[model samples]
Target: MNNLSKTTLIDQLTVEVYQNRNILGQEAAKAVVLKMKELLSNKNRIRMIFAAAPSQNEFLETLTKAEGIDWSRVTAFHMDEYIGLPASASQRFGRFLKERLFDTVKPGVVHFIDSENSIEEECKRYADLLSEQPIDMVCLGIGENGHIAFNDPPVADFQDPSIIKSVELDLVCRQQQVNDGCFTDLKSVPTQALTLTIPTLVAANYLFCIVPGTNKSEALKHTLSGPITTDCPASILRQHGHCTLYADDDSFELVANG
Candidate 1:
């Protein structure tokens, strides 16, 4: 928790503000590592879900470099992946996670969402994989539209029965893909995606939310002060028993000013 300058406990959520994004990621990764160690010491294996995006770059990179943890006892799953995107597409979410962290670690298993397969069967298969074990933790970020994964405002369900479901991408979410340089333009972005539902994500025993960059200021503000509604999907984090939000100055200042 080095250089964590401020903290606010809103409801069940603990929000930590860092001096910068690098520090934010480092501290979040450190906290997650500590939690993982504790879980592994008591449990035979731990399950983890991760979000793939430029916002998670620093946290995932720092986590991959952390030492002394037996990654072989960990099983990895990603939060979402686009439908119909070719495997070769650099923008594919699964490909992004593989290049950034999954390939770097020796997790006992890495379950990827098969978006190319039948959406119904893919959803069932992924849900079965998730239901195999309780998720110990998740490292995620908020989208510019305040989305948690692809559960955009229009599609997010707080009590979704299915663990994994498909959704049509929101305009703001698609625009963010372009802004993050995952695609050259909005037209290149996939309209539909398979996302772990809001209930599935919040079900984790612990949640490490790393949201950075000035582009996230507005979303951060909404999540921090706005009503806890699907209008700001990430706002639901406030109700989690063990969730912490790590944000940098660029994004935190928006809430600070208000």
Candidate 2:
């Protein structure tokens, strides 16, 4: 594996913040979509993983609106979902993807975790579905606590063999859901979730991590400067072969000033 501790690795993966968050989101989306298009042009098929949250709103909008890409050749998968939430639920990650991207384009396949089903069954089912294909690209966002997907500080593991598992929600992660308008209050959000594991995320050929806003500044710093431990789940991206971080002025402040 490549050494993430090397100065060149940090310099290579770190992207300077943009003047505005929206602009940063759009640029990152454009770059990833273009790369996806290039890969699809050569391979004829592409599998992609998407992360859903208020933070990814601009990025998804820009990707869905972009022209010339053959959406029909793309297969889509998402990062995580709240266990026990129906697909029709407003807070379901599947619904977010359908409303935000799938409905707008003719994608070949969309495999969504059925959070309403038995947690273990849902995890096994999604893992089986994903096991068949190698992900061409993954678009994700870092949580305020530096969590990736639902791999909160307590449960994240970079070397775990399990591709997907049920996990309890952290207090900070739940609060963030409410703050993002996914729910009116903490009680409205599910306490448990099914998320793709860190190992699965790192297996992707390319990773595009988009983080914006002042709220993410501290987490961004931890992700970039902190040790690669489960306590800082997003930091595992540093070990991936091809990973890019896109942040806005506020989110990149720590890295920039350092």
Candidate 3:
């Protein structure tokens, strides 16, 4: 927990601003590791969902090297994946997690969405795996558009009845992939993706949302100060009692004086 600069609450969500992205990732990993240890102390195993993007690089790196936790007792899942990316594409969420986390920690169980299969069947398959257990934790990030997972504003539903569903990606959401260096251009990014619903994400017992960078400043501001609406999807984090947002000074700049 180094370089913590500010802390506040918006509704039930706790916001922690660190001096930089490195500190933000370090502190977030430290807190999540402690939570994992606590949950494992009582349960035979714990389930966790992860978000894959450059925003998670430092956090995943730190978490993989954290000590004192039995990774064998942890089960992992990713929040979303593109429906059309080739299996070898590095931009694919599943590949991103494997290279960053699953391969490093070797979790007891890692459920991945196989988009190569029929889209409908793949969604149903992944949904069944998610429903088999209660998710104990989720490590996620907000999009530049303030969306969570792939739940872009145009398709986000706070009261969604589905555990997972495929949605057409909006222009801003697709362009963000290019902005993040995941795709060479917006045309190369997948137009559709399967994402865990907003309800499914908040259903987790604890949520750690790691968002950083000046690129995220405007979205972060809307998420923290705007009304709880799908217009700024991540704003719903405020309603989750156990969710915490980890942001760095750069990302918090716009909201610092609010």
Candidate 4:
């Protein structure tokens, strides 16, 4: 087996694949906070999109503890949410942000997709809102299947125009949620989700993606070494001007042992 390690890509895009998952998560969170501070020093306001998943637990915890960030001037948004789920549901991204980042920092604004509302109407409304702003940064994670947000391989579109859309969940993605303990079984997970499109996520000035654990190894390889295609939605990050990836030992196997 190959040992995992970190690699520095061109520009400021560094990929750190650590042996310790907790260390990897903390480092990623710290890097994001530092980047946010640097951007805020120049920009009047900052907008951010966050991904909610068990993989992000450690990173989010570290971020919520980061000081020196003016949360009041920052507007927050989430990557995606399960359609038809109530905001109060434990599985809801809205509730996750409220408990994890929002209540702690109280950002200037929080734009959460109303998954409980009609999916089509909510998608159009959210797309309009995102279209009006240039997001400063986005924190995301890759699914075990290499999906970004809810843009599963089958539904992902690199040329998508709208910022938000409803997508059917892929089998691998659903299984991932179960494996991560987000749901008791496959049937408990939603069949569809409201996800931010590829163009919208890439529109951000910076993208900080965190991928940890052994389960993510294959997906990480595809994201880092594969062609930029919807087959691996995260591969699109390669085209962004300022995109960085953080991975732990298991997830970094390909890059590290190369």
RMSD (CA, Å), each prediction? 0.8, 4.2, 0.8, 2.8
Model 4: residue 14 alpha-carbon error in angstroms: 3.3
Residue 255, model 4, lDDT:
53
Which lDDT values do the candidates have, in the order given? 0.93, 0.85, 0.94, 0.85
Q: Could you give me the TM-score of model 3 versus the true structure?
A: 0.98
Who is ahead in lDDT, 1 or 2? 1
Clashes of 3: 0
TM-score attained by model 4: 0.93
Which stretches in model 2 have alpha-carbon errors above 4 Å? 1-12
Worst 10 residues of 3 by lDDT: 1-10
Query: Candidate 2: how many backbone clashes?
Result: 0
- Superposition error at 137 for model 4 (Å): 0.3
TM-score versus the correct structure, for each prediction: 0.98, 0.93, 0.98, 0.93
Model 2, span 163-192: residue lDDT tens: 999999999999999888889988988999
Best by lDDT: 3
Local accuracy of candidate 3 as per-residue lDDT tens digits, 1-258: 458899999999999999999989989999999999999999999999999999999999999999999999998999999998889988889999999989989999999988888988988998999999889999999999999999999999999999999999999999989999888987899999999999999999999999989999999999999999999999999999999999999999999967
Residues 43-159 of candidate 4: C-alpha lDDT, one tens digit per residue:
888889999998888899898899999988898999999986666689998788788878988898898889888877898888877777788899999998889889999998889
TM-score of the candidate numbered 2?
A: 0.93
Candidate 1, residues 1-258, lDDT tens digits: the string is: 469879999889999999999998888888999999999999889999999999888899899999988999999999999998988888888889999998888789899988999999999999999998889999999999999989999999899988999999999999999999888999999999999999999999999999988999999999999999999999999999999999999998889999
